[model samples]
Target chain A: MSKAERKAEVVDLKDRAAARQERLPVLKTYKLFIDGKFPRSESERYYALTSANGESIANVQLGSRKDFRNAVVAARKAFPGWAGRTAYNRGQILYRMAEMLEGRRAQFIEELETLGASRSEAETETAMAVDRLIYYAGWADKFQQVFSSVNPVASSHFNFSMLEPTGVAALLAPEDSGLLGLISVVAPAVAGGNSVVVLASHSKPLAAITFSEVLHTSDLPAGVINILTGTRKELLKHFASHMDVNALVYCGSDAEEIRTVQLEAAENLKRVVIEENSDWQSEERQSPYTILATQEVKTTWHPIGL
Target chain B: MPRNNAALAVTLPPQFVPIDEVGIDERVSRFSKRSIKKSSKVQALKLALSMLDLTTLSAHDTPERVRQLCHKAKNLLETMPELPHVGAVCVYGPLVKVAKEVLKGTKIHIAAVSTAFPSGMAPLKTKLIETRQFVADGADEIDMVISRGKFFEGDYDYVADEIAAVKEACGKAHLKVILETGELNTLDNVRRASDIAMHAGADFIKTSTGKVQPAATPQVTLVMLEAIRDFYYATGKKIGMKPAGGIATAKQALHYLVMLRETLGEAWLTPDLFRFGASKLANDILMQLVKEQTGAYQSIDYFSME
Candidate 1:
């Protein structure tokens, strides 16, 4: 071809490339966070996410039951290391998570807004989620003190009951308050040293995926908190029935879902904590008692000197 | 007939067996993808369980710990009484008697690692004495480590001679020559060492000593299994295969079994012809078996920690 014709072809190609760059928006592929790494669903399946007004968002990973099983395995593998950490150290890490979340406030707010929340509501939810993390951070080192008791026994023995974190916990984040509800349930469980496999809010999962980024950077050990974005209806049964999960914490009070969780959990006799139709944004939601729900009471007796 | 025929020596010469690294990786990946579910999964798990040589080779291992491991090998999860006992209990030479004492009445053989174990750095005389002593102390199997240093130095004959000497010292006890493929560095070397060990009269060719990184990987295992198959084809002798270290999951154990069956056929799928030298693999197989039975995943807490 002639030099003039070649130059014209190059110019046309450059123009099309520029137009493509401007027209196509860069979208984040939401994936499951298991064992501290971001991986697509094991089944390689995805579901299209849409906003309240039918505006298309992006395709999110459709995690299968195998994903939940993998998360449980990760949580179980990380339980001993997480639970073995000093309570003060756990508190510091939880506080650091709050700090990381504060740094990502703008990102979370934008995600919430894209999910159909108003600017002010997104701001409030992000702030409340950060504050909720701080609330649990403070409770991390003090919950055992409040829950423990020196029992008075009739025998010549010294008896006392102390609180220990339950093993692996499976959590279902509330469908409404995506960010706040997730932090409310997760912060408490991790603060008490229970590693968790959480199913993020089905309708508002953008903030949850972004929140996992905050957790990734906060020195919280991997597998201590695994988050999966998928339909809760499909995953809740496996989450509750997994024998490796020592505790099941369901944030929503849907009668049918609660019944399924309770029934499946009976197979392993797991500790089931149901928060029915609870307002995660309420002041009552942030407390030490939330941390205590995933803890077990260990009573020990020391024989006195005769 | 003599275990090591004169013709075997001619075929066992250490020569370059060029390995296709890409081909091995591709073949090994397929083993893990096979869906052995339901009754097949349960059968594979039980078969894997029966092939386990539950091992504890730590410096911290004591007589009490050996006794505990032997007990676990004999009675894996008392709640599941129908489960078959493991193939053997593997321990240090000094601990073999301790394990033998606990596994007295059971079919579980006591396999002892000798010849300086993880590091075959001792003299030939020392290795023979260790092997003979363990055999005299009631060990039914002797897992001897081949000299990796000599093998790397192009001293193929020395490596073969050492394995032969150790095999002679083992007398009637089956000899499992540990190639410790982790240090061997290449699939070609793994195949070469496997060929050398088998020719040197290794009744069983093992992958690791449970003390090295990158042990018993699928690629290395496939190479070793292929070597064993070629050797069997040439000599009409079935040499057992043990991919020992780093095989801690039930799924991985199943994968190894699949590779073995596909490579060497079902004739080698027995405790007499195959073994898994692992401490954690037994419980995982038990957990999988329990899951298959109850239709629920199991917790490690429900099983004993050996």
Candidate 2:
């Protein structure tokens, strides 16, 4: 080909590439995670949150009280089926979720970019979240073995001990972590056969709800995980005080709020897990022991027949 | 007893020659000859590695190989108690408070890289605000990089003023002006940057952001240290020095220390006078210390970097 003809061909290729770039899909708005499905917010009260550099990257719904009620209802419904599943079965399901999450990593990366994370930060956080899911998934079946035992009684009685999940849990994910914190807390609780209601990060909730969609598509039973995106103060106090919530896991830096939640959780004698403001990277991976922390050891003794 | 300033002058080897005496043409030709032969891929990796601050390693590195490295360097620092402490355990900014708490009552000051470190591309007001926030959070020192674009465009006055304003904003906290030597291009410009920052009231002159190619190198550090020495002679005040970026192994840190010892003498060897702004160096130093004290090499797997 002549030089001009070759140049013309290159320009055509460039145009095609530009067109492809322009056709990239924009992110969704106003999402909710409930009953293993990502549903649009009941009301369209969406608002945009800007990054430190003043770029509007994420759209969050001002989740209402009705949204919280629906989420709790869904989680409450999911509790029986999920909690009744055998530990081995739950472990397999969680591992499958991790596999699915790993496959869609680029989607999460784009979501993270929309949430204003630097390229490195977005990749690391997403990878860590997936790794965390796998880490906790491996713990599902092992927790009972690690935390329970068959007891030797003084009398001729059969005694065995086993750890049981705390029914339903409520969590406030960390603001800075976006999807990572949301998934980290939710995955561990669900992997242990407990249902959860999580309040997504206020500023960056898109990724959390998108992750919820992932969970929805996974083989996970409905109502096992419910996510709401809103202000922490508005949702957290209610979750903390909810008598139905058997435990509360709060990922936040504010000392005073943590203290108040710890105190309020006492009302139901609820189990409270607090992750102090820290590099999540430094946190020990969740294991069977982690499940034991939120579970109760149940022991039963049977009298020997004469 | 009066301190002798002459003792602080760095000694050169008999064969060592000044760059000026060697001539710019010769230096450029020599640099090109050495640089061009390397594969672009290898150079990219070297450049990428050079850009990493490695601060996160200080918090989470636990491989036995890594621990051994830390142990070695820690021991050396302990033995040379007279040497200045390494710069703050430069962790993620949130860890600034943790470092402060950990290093409490110790003479070792806490330093945090703020103002969107590695690149001061953020707004000046935002940078100042961040500096103030870090200081408020108990950081004793702040290290910030100059606007590379401004410096490259011969806008030295703007760069100098920015450093001065940051110095003023620092209040009681010390400010370390990072020259980002790899991007500075010429020794003359590097020298000029040192003078500008010193005149602008920088408490110390730092070498790199650990986020730029060719960050902190012996050659670059040697040039900056000489500039600091010269500035000290011209002005009565002595400025501190920090060579950050890609300093992982104990040997590299020791080499830098040796450079400091030979150039600035024992006076500049203290934590107050000098610091190795690194994440991995501390652990490597600690590992060496452990080996020295225990008389056995311990598996590094047991210890978390934090």
Candidate 3:
């Protein structure tokens, strides 16, 4: 090409670059959510998050086992009050969380977009997350009636069985689905009146932190749902081995992590539930059984003698 | 003069200087930031274990619980035979005999919370009676709470006399004067209380009763440590320091150790000079030691609960 033509091409490219730089996006500082506060990881480490096209988007806190340990402490501390709240009050809090999520829809969608989800897919995930909250909110009070049983014994005794929340649950949110999977896991656990410490999707954690903000503002108590940003493999063992954590819920396909969780959870006889499914958007994802997964059945017998 | 007795004149300092709150906080934060690494961290954890006064001062504590606590004080972790047990077993005055039975020939001693314990509302005669009883029951040390009401009334003489009276009653048992710093509500008050306790004959100056709102924070502990340091310089006698309550994490324990070391040097690292009055701190230290020995984190389930 001639010098004049090459110069013209270069000028056009410079104009394009200037136009793109006119509006710089504000980057969010993603941090670990422990007890109800967003703190830089105690380890002070970070992991770069990039778009599918390899464009750097933001930096996420690379939580250490210490962070998970802190989260478990928070979860255990918050367990009694969260579990003791009236079922109706818990339902109301969950619904309030849904309201807060609704108010933050655009932010969640934007975060999803940064994670490289298509615009429509991002909106869908955000909506599903809000719906998941609402769904669990409805079930919070109803699950008791649905699952409880008044048993007939051979003797003249009043026998009844009911479900109770397992204390503090440590969970790994599905690695593939950010907002929706997180809501699905946490809603069921919280609906069953259990406090949860969850490690968010390592590859896509923006929405999880945003969701923690929602939980923070709503009536939900501090430490009811703690979110951590880090690699699942690195934090999985800590999540499983924490003595204070009463339940372990995993939603990932990695075989080694599954095995490790099972083996470590046996130390405390923690309720280990592993549900690895890829399609979170499917109808089968929402069920009372998910709530039951984090609950314990307690039976009582009282003799009816006057 | 007995080597253990210091400042025979017993003249109270004319004025306790007001601490620089911001400066103390900044220094504590700095001390907290020291990056203790692997082998050294393990060593520090062990040292912290050796400094713990495994305490169970609950109102519901039974002889069985006291015995169990003493048992734990003697054998922190059977799996790690080399690990030292906690410095002592602390229980209510009435249960001192139970703990003494379990701790008979071991290096672990028995600390009894006497003088009405968590509360110091009783008459002086009653407190002396309690202290004398605990000593007779074989308690190696007596933890006594000061009268905050009298201190708040500007009755400095009453406070000093109470400490001296309690000390006389303790006789052979070492006296730990708990200022209950949380009730004092100010750093200057904490400093003044520390001076009063030390001048009136306290072997160890403690921060709280483990029953108050804000027990044993770094600022308060630092102020008390500084008081010990000053007393040591003036009289050429060492006054031990015990930061009891709210120090439940290995990291927090390390921070306290750092402060103690920086303030009083390596001599205070031993159980005799420095100690932690805590029921949960021992388990947390053991968990850290286990985590260090085995890369995997620990469940409290594996550790026997007293």
Candidate 4:
């Protein structure tokens, strides 16, 4: 064929490929994470997740209060062991999780594409999520050094304080970021030695569960991280008021609801960390100091005289 | 007739004043002749600043960056006392909250650029919903772009009705209709857009979305401001003006201010009549103010409240 005809043929092939892509069936799946296992809901209730174009991509189970309780219990049970580990060991585990995430980057990108993210956005979010994990992982051992300070007391007692993890935290991941939001909230709390019960993004829960799978595959002990998929109104109230939850971390666009939860947390004086609706792509996200700011330090004094 | 003749006869001998007898003093002409002193309040400058393009500093220029730019601009505005508070920080819908937080408790309002922004290619329903959501997120203003596609196709009614719908959806929040004069390609189209927007209940007529390559030139701003003046004169209702996109430095802001002062006079100098949609211009103005006050150029580190 002539050069022009060959170019026309190539164009024809490209058009056919595009047509084929439009006709491909969208796969749908959903399950809950309880004690490091993907389990079907006891109630068997499922909610349809749709795209901006109104096409159904998946059906996510509407997890119940019982599911939330179970996750919290599992998190509480796992917290002692996970929190007891040395900071270096936890850092290494988080770092390894980042590597595993990098290995499955394509899976996340595919899931994001199904959830309506543009190809470029999906790639950037996936890379940023992995990098965020790595960034927080590095801060795991150093957060204490930055947040902690030795006080110069008038007396003989040496006084120094270091940030301590608030245990069994509950997080409401942002709806826009399917995987990155899940990882952003969970990794920071976990790196600080706090076990988390994450309420997955209602519209895009598949990637959250998929990341849970990655966590399960990693050396993370069962119950150290529990993922529950449900409505924010349904699950967030329980998470906020639960006496056992030591802290609450919420990341979403619902300002009023988040504020209500913050007020509820005040009933027990539970530590509240509300991530404002912010562009995660901005320079504000790179501040390692924010992760340290969310935690607290506990100090004790001893006498060395006689 | 007799009474009129007697009155006219009494007015016959008027006092003669020669040019030399009239003591015309330079100070009298300079001071007592309605001096029309320019306002030292910087209100016109503030309005021009509100329409400036403040997103040039981003790593990648997109709607998201436009949102961040508004946020940074809002933060910078917090420090200035002389500049009239901006009407709103215009950005994409997703970043409305960022501007909301940055402008919390201040007179300045949050404005989101909707209707597909620079292009206005999205469906009208989507644009309306996006505008509504931004208002729901505490945006006090909506800056929507005219559909360039429809405009180019000579679908003037479609473009006008879209602006009307967005204006209605804006509820109590004011709507600033952007003409994208650079894309309009003619002063006639710009004038037509201004008239259409005004007839459609637009609170203000704006220029450019800042995403287009050639945004908010002085010529365009001058034309739009003249249109606003004409519309007001014809209808006896004042319409505001916003010249946005690619306006940065203090000198450019001053030029627009000068234009508004010279063209619209004092009435359009307020935030209600004029605004600059800028992110970085606020800081540059503030930096200049600080230098003028302190007699030294402060380091960039000094403005690190963000």
Candidate 5:
């Protein structure tokens, strides 16, 4: 046969094969993000996620206390480096994370919709989440100046109060709006220079786990934000009690759980910030105060110069 | 065993075979993939806890810090008094007195890493003096480093003599010969060193000085454990194995335990025969045990930092 006819025959065979079978859609395995790496929960236990129709979407890792402990270890290890970075550098890294989130915006929207969000709601939430990251990025360098003050004293000493990152913070993301709530809690803590162990909203975790991808690729140092997909009730007590965690931010309104958090946190005197039913899209939620909530104030006294 | 002149002349047994690189890599990958979950996992973690040689070998380690470590070794899980304590507290010779004082009236033994420690570069006389000083200060075990430079120089006799001398200096205190396997760079050399240390009267054959990279890798550890098994077959003596350093997580500790159990059977399961020379493993295991009982994820923050 002529060369052209041979090519036609090859194309015919390829078309026949394509017609016979199409590749299946790839489903991601959502694992816990600890330190800079992806790890299945050491418990090896998994809870399945379903759509509105109850069809299984994926298996999200059931992060146990061991997983949280490992994440805390990672967060603590990353804290020194993250907290020590120049404010400008941290801002750039946070901005880079925003950029990554923007790039993967469509995937996040799709994930939200798959978990029962309307298209418009998903789109708006995803946009808000990206904007929230950028908001925090800007605050990374400016929050210290906004919160710090030089105090007037009677003595010969010049006293000044400056905000410092709380080292390692435990974050329980709001059980509502995946994209907005996770980013709102995480963005500020990271902006203020604290590393965090964020338990993504169990009912709405896809966006959070997907956000870990944004973090993984961004210039933000590893372990700055460890995102876990698990129940807050089971993990919160350990989160509150862990001695290494300098602060814990809980974003739900459960009275018993709050009491447990308070009681457990007292063991190590960890700072507890409760955000009960707070709307992430509200003006109140977009302030530098959220960042300060995860920070500790250091007052230094300097001798007055002649 | 005395430092016998005739035993020093005895050649290494033929079972000190060359390590198969591909085979070892494959076997280790398999070990890394195996998961022991639930109650069995908790039991394994607790066993691993009992096998820990809680180490603080930094040059900056103070008596206060060592004392704190000894306290941690004894009260590994103070909140849960039923939890088992660590096998021993490992420290430098100078800190042995403080560690012993803190560990007084406790079942936890104090292990001192002598023989010039991480660098084994000091004169043999100085190492001997240090060993005796540690023993005098009430160190129950002596973890001695072999001169790697001499071993790499093919001075097997010198290496054997050095280990023997340190073992003699250890006297009633058990002697653990650290091969610093990272520096050895070859599994064959590690196997040979294991044999030499065993023959030279090391009560325990240890993997690293916690100051070296590539410490207690599964492949290297397996080779040493095999040497131990062979030594047991020949002399009917159970020489302990300590895979010290870089083993921080509970999962890694249990992996070591599983390797030990499958390789040497239940005889080596106890802390007396198979120990983990690890600084962070105790807390990690404690976290796991708490997670098991409480159904909550733990944080190092609530756990003891030391």
Candidate 6:
């Protein structure tokens, strides 16, 4: 064969290999995280997510009320077990979550950037999320000690107060910093020994779902932290009105939404804590009060000799 | 004894209508997919509430537990005084008297689980005495388990004769024959057992003893429902169906009702012709009904734990 013909054959083989590599990339399907498993919406509905430049990013699950109900059931099922664990074990698990997130730091940063955060903002948010988990982990074993009290009653009886987990918590993560916002809300509730069903930031949900992957592998029990990706406007009422939720944490300042939550939460008198328009990255956002928000105070009186 | 004509001679090589497993699965799937919405959902929940046989057949059943169950059966929810009483309170033979004293003057029937209960391994003479004693102790219904071992040994006639004898001992009490379809193994066997039970004078044919896995599944319920329909057509006797065990959700109870409505044409929708031998299912139905009334999901914590 001629040299020209051999060179042409080599070029053709390279072109074939390039074409094979250029086949459509396999995309990740963002699904609802319930009971530590990734499940698509039971309603079989999906919503398209887009970047700031109007470029389609991905199709994310549009969770239904039924999904919310199922998540609550799982959360309630996990509550007793999660709450019954020693605070030290829970703290260890939370620290393990931070370790998992740190191991996958690059992946989360890339995910946040793809969802439209700038590089610096994505890096800051990812770092804060890991630190926030560690912060709550430390509080898991100390909050009760700080909040519980030995009361001195006038009557001849021994009285004392102790903090207990407020059972299932329903949280609506802030719409701004998806990663840090979700971590801030979830860490406190779980560290206090309460299971949670959280609705992630509607626009930037990619990081929140990826964070669930961290929790899934970090020894966090299934259903202790269920994260769902969906629009807040659609799920706000269900999050507020579900009777099984003993506490609710909503991060926004919309008066109408707050009113709806307060009014509907009265159906079962769910303890609600609203953080309005606060910057999530501030040092003040990492307070132990966040953990106390979902803890119930139980006062016991013991009969004693006068 | 209200003996059926088919009981006169037990047919050897008994004729059982073969169940189309695929067809049954398809039909059951459709029933579950049905949209029972708005006012219809409320009505269905209420109907299901009335059809429940609140059962407590544990080996550790105490008189106090039976009494508590009877109270729950009579007054489902004190807060919701508008709800109807459960159809029956099902207990062990000895506990029937305890349940009867609590449910006396109420329309709720007391059903006793007899014939060695979950195992059904006792002698026929002992079973007869147990049934008669339960009836004399004010049990309005007797749920008897068929000898599954005899059925598996191909002794169809012994199974038939045993059921007839139990029915005679029942006297004025309604007789519900439990086939324990989970042990029967196949849909064909479930159908054959349903036919044998119906022909031997079962006022209601039940699916389980609540002690086995894979109990009262949609496929088994469907096969039994079809058998009941065919028997109605041939002998003009409308038999009842009770799919006990594992039917713990209101959605599942509604699906069974849908299957019953479609297969038997609404004639067997009444409590007299249908029953649910369930304990947890009552709370679920109450939760759904309360959710319908108040527009919020409910918690098991708020309901009685019978």
B13-59: candidate 4 lDDT, tens digit per residue: 12221222122232222222232223542443445554543433232
Runs with alpha carbons beyond 4 Å of true place in candidate 2: A1-25, B1-306
Restricted to chain B, the TM-score per model reads 0.95, 0.70, 0.95, 0.74, 0.94, 0.95
TM-score winner between 2 and 5, please give it: 5
Superposed on all Cα atoms, model 5 deviates from the true structure by an RMSD in Å of 4.8
Give the candidate number with the greatest TM-score: 6
> What DockQ does model 6 achieve?
0.82
lDDT of 6 by residue, A1-306 (tens): 899999999999999999999999888999999998999999899999998789888899999989999999999999999999999999999999999999999999999998878899989888988999999999999999999999989998899999999999999999988899889989999999999999999888998888888888998889999999888888999999998999999999999999999998988999999989559988888999989899999999998995
Instruction: Please write out the lDDT profile of model 5 over residues A169-232, one tens digit for every residue.
Output: 9999899878898888888998888999999999988888888888999977889999998888
Return the TM-score for each candidate structure: 0.89, 0.45, 0.84, 0.45, 0.80, 0.94
Give the candidate number with the greatest lDDT: 6
Poorest lDDT segment (10 consecutive residues) of candidate 1 chain B: B1-10
TM-score quality measure for candidate 3:
0.84
The sequence of per-residue lDDT tens digits that candidate 6 reaches over residues B52-113 is 99988899999999999988887888888998888998999998878878877899999999
Q: Model 4: how far is B224 from its true place, Å?
A: 93
Q: Relative to the true structure, how large is the alpha-carbon lDDT of every model?
A: 0.88, 0.70, 0.89, 0.74, 0.87, 0.91
lDDT of 1 by residue, B171-252 (tens): 8999999999989998889988989888889999999987789888889888988888888778899999888888889989
Q: Count the backbone clashes (under 3 Å) in each candidate.
A: 0, 22, 0, 16, 7, 0
- Ranked by lDDT, the better of candidates 3 and 4 is 3
Q: What share of the true interface contacts does candidate 1 keep?
A: 0.72
Give the runs in model 3 whose Cα sits over 4 Å from its true position. A1-24, A110-116, A152-156, B1-22, B58-62, B113-133, B144-171, B183-200, B301-304
3 against 6, candidate with superior DockQ: 6
Docking class of 3: acceptable
Worst 10 residues of 6 chain A by lDDT: A275-284
Clashing pairs in 1: none
Please give the lDDT score at residue A164 for candidate 5.
Answer: 89
Q: How well does each candidate reproduce the native contacts, as fnat?
A: 0.72, 0.00, 0.61, 0.00, 0.50, 0.89
lDDT tens digits by residue: candidate 2, B177-226: 98888898877777778777777788989888777778877777777777
For residues A1-306, could you state the per-residue lDDT of candidate 3 as single tens digits?
Answer: 999999999999999999998887776798889999999999999999888889888899999988888888788789889999999999999999999999999999999988889999999999999999999999999999999999989988999999999999988898899999988999999999999999999988989988888988997788889999998878888888776788999997789889999998887789999988878999988999999999999999988985
